[model samples]
Target: MVHGRKFISVLTLTVLVLGPGAWAGTETGMKGALADIPADVMGFVCVPSAKALDEKVNKLMQQLGLAQFMPTSLLTLVKEQTGVGDALDEAGSLALIVYEPASPSPDELHNAAVILLPTANAAQLLESLKAGEETDGVRPLSFFGRDQFAFSKGGHVYIGASKATLKKVAASEKDITSRLDPASLGHLQTLDLAVWVDAQKLVKLVKPFIDQLQEMAKAQAQGSGAGSFTAIQLRSMTRSINMLTEGLESAQIGVSLTPKGLGVSFLMATRAGTKMCELVEASPSTDKSLMVGLPADKFIVAGGQIMQAEATKESITDLDALFEAEELKQHCDVQQLGTIRDSIREMLLALRGASFSISALPESPEGLVGLTVVSKVVDGQKWMDNLAKVVAACKKVTQKEEVAKALELVKHEAGAATVEGTKVDRLSFDLAAFTEMEEKEVEEMKKVLGSDGVSVRLAAASPEHVVITFGGGEARMAEVLKLVKAGGSPLGEDAGIKKVSSSLPGKRYSEVYFAGDRLVALLSSIGKVTGNELPIRMAEVNAPVALVSSSQGPCCQVDVFVPMEMVVAIKDTVMQLMGAMMGGAKQTQDDTL
Candidate 1:
């Protein structure tokens, strides 16, 4: 039986996956259940077997060293709520199929969704219904907060919004399961949970909602000229929304738990020959070498390829129009702004990829955080030229009192420096220069950073790339440029990083790598300083965390991989915290006595 809470959860999952499975195996009635699904469904949610999933989760919990903290059995709760017996044990799979209107009616939509439950004993299941009456071969019942129809046939029980829906599914002779991708089905067969959707059909079903949104936007812009900045921006956004919906062909999501780790993957495929598909096709793969020149000990490293030229150019034109608008034109110099815009466009057009690295977090609020950013460009000279223009334009605006103060600080605190034959721009400042703080607090910050001033540097890493350095000073800048000159392998080529990356899809538009071991250590140190030690003491594990987004054929895939060691640490930490809380409560009771 489908309860309201559970039904709503299924529906929520369907939507979350939009932007974004086990049976107790056996020949179990899965085949018959699939055969009864309506062929023209807008979408369907499938659970291979609730019992199988429960077993797999319990086993995984045990594998992660969480057996002592296992929760109550899921099936027991289901039986308590539905008043169904062993009949559920024989139920191999559950499916809820969403369909278009059966027939248009003036009163309300005739649209419906049907739930198919495969059970060998239909009589036992029927007896558990709270209130129902037989009508023809179907039973009319109140389920999921509404009047619904239910019937049993061919080792399965079908329930839906109306008898018409039940009839279509029960009479389905076309193998509806054939519509799904074979790969998705194969994955579902082995995973604990999964969902697949016919994206095109879903778009048709949700078109009314999209249309309403567009109408609302038009209403908001009622009196504005079509050529107005707000109106043009609105139109552009609407086009993007339509393209996203119309371009998608299919989508599937899967969740799995194993000794390696727990994994959730979402894949979305665009229709062939669509503009969205073309955009993805034009995206370049992430260059792993972009990680070079970044310090090897950074806690986080992230990089991605830039969008195609057409999109960038369109964005620049929109900015120009925005600056020219009457409302904005009165604020500042339009001509200088145009120069800044052109320089920006030049820089963006030459960019291929960029990467950023955070070496360390500040120990205190006043402490300086250290980091570096590098951009791979086709023409480094153009990047440098544009950067100078931007600086000059910014200087012109400093005539204002507040602006002049900031400009003076920049000129006083930073300037050009020679590091290993390369002219690098460096900036160094103390918290006192920017904010009012107690002298002792300022001293503490300086002590933590090992200097009275925090510094950053900028330099051309190569003929094709430029680099920016923060906090590490000349030594760090020299080291970074040395790596560029050496053309050495990036830290990602290390064994730990390679292991994590290899587990994810290889053709990525973007990727992020995390040093979990260093992160945990940092957190532990922070906890000790704050006098809040964690209950469970964990040793640093050698696994790295990775998130990668890539394209496989027409499908867009985003995968996040967290190593099993991290999972174990998290589980142990949670269990220990609960135990400590319980112990504290007992101690409090004794004290009251």
Candidate 2:
């Protein structure tokens, strides 16, 4: 795209130069000047030699009927005697002579001398000479002054002057002397004023010759065709000139010629001054959608920090050993396993060594215990495998006779077992159960007492009053309340039936019974008080059944149907219970009031 823009600028410059208005004045001047020379002299000037100049001048004189007066011998004699060579050597001193005579002269008497100057400034000299003012030997002459010499034949103007005046025409003579800078005019006298004037005329005649030479150049460029040779040659020559001057600085140019038109283009760098040009001859392509493309350089970078953090969090330790384990054979490629393991192990090690802390709730919510593990360097995969093994081992140990025996001994000493085990570390189940029951009692009290229909309304009616209502009235409510307050019945004592309270003012009654997973008390006034018989529907908890048979080597399946509603209720209840238990001490006023 950049190259194309440059090409158009060059083409536009060429068009401007060749337009109709260009060179108008120069063309007019060339035509007017050349018309004054005789046709034969014009023809000689077109040739490329000095010998042709003499031959053409002689022919022109004969054709003008001056052959009888100005004989060839006389012309030769005049040329030899005068020091005209020096005048011609000087810049812009050459001129043509025209003579007017009623009859021929014995000494070949001279006429007006028409000097040709290099530039327009010479026209002033010619004008001064015609005015005949002796001002520093320079004079101005008119274009028509040559007619006074009787040499204006065929509508061409001529100049006339005497031999004395010609000798005194020292302006050009002085110019020649200055240019040569000779100490004396001794042997150099042959190169005199007349000779100088003649040389200037000869040079003026050579103008048409130079034009013809340019024409020849045009012909060569166009292969001698008359068709637009000048324009073609101008374009070719200008292109060559531009290439020589511009293309040397890494500038490139191209030209194309086609049946329809010609095109040229150039490209240059803005910063380096380097350029390129191309010319293509084209008719518009038939396809309208052709596209051009330009290309440039671009740079980019890869890899960042966030990815490292994510990798660390998910990593496990001892991943290398897991890679070597046989159990992973079907799931992972053995060769790549080592690599995967190493990377994971390194990541785990990084995470473990990092100074960080994490807190997690115990797997069993009944235990108000939390598990906190500090970051530590451990084989991550091995740790995970060992954890699984510990769970399986612990489950087995829980049912083992040895573990039961140890628990029995502890219970004998402490009145309750509270064994703490390692591997699958846990406090004894009995102690855990007791702790759970106590927490549950506090939670249930908050729930029942905090409700607006219960605590608020009842407390408003009587601040210290007790509305002891249960599924089985005052007697059963009293026993259940006792069990809650004392944590559990004394370890070895047979919990005696007793009437702790009755709704009927001073009436008291009691009966003992075990009911529906809870111990209960019965009274005559309060029917079945202790056990509320919670509305629970039994749900079959399906455990995964791992089966191994010869046909199906190792397969596992689960037969289970979980009560979705129960699970949701359990989760909500546990959350509420936990909140209440944690806040219980602080919320005592809220509960009672």
Q: Relative to the unseen true structure, what is the C-alpha lDDT of residue 398 in candidate 2, on a scale of 0 to 100?
A: 38
- Cα error of candidate 1 at position 277, Å: 1.8
Most TM-score-accurate candidate: 1
Q: Residues 1-593, candidate 2, lDDT per residue (tens digit)?
A: 44343323322211221221110112223233333333221111111112223343455345434457654642244223331222221212123433222222322222322223222233342343344444333333333223121111222222333433333332122232232212111112211111111222333434466557666676674663323434444544644544334422111122211121122222221112322112111111111101001000010100001112332432242233334444445444454445455544553544322111111111221221111121222443344343334333333333346554443432211111111110112212243233445765544433332211111000000111111121211222233233323333221121111111110012101111111111111111012122354223222111111111000001111111112222333444455556767687568868888
lDDT of each: 0.62, 0.26
lDDT string for model 1 (1-593, tens) is 34445445324322322211222333333444455566677666666566666676667656766657655655565555445566654336666676665332311132366666567778777766543778866887655445667888775677766677677776776655676555344434544445667887766766787889999888765657655667767777887787789788878776655556656677776777987777655666654544755656545444434456765665666665665554444444667777777787788878767777765544544233457677778876668767877666665643567655664555322238777787776555545676766776566556445352565677776788787876555666787788766765465565566777656666677777776556656556545654555555555565667777776556667777787777677667677778889999999999999
Per-residue error (Å), model 2, residue 175: 6.6
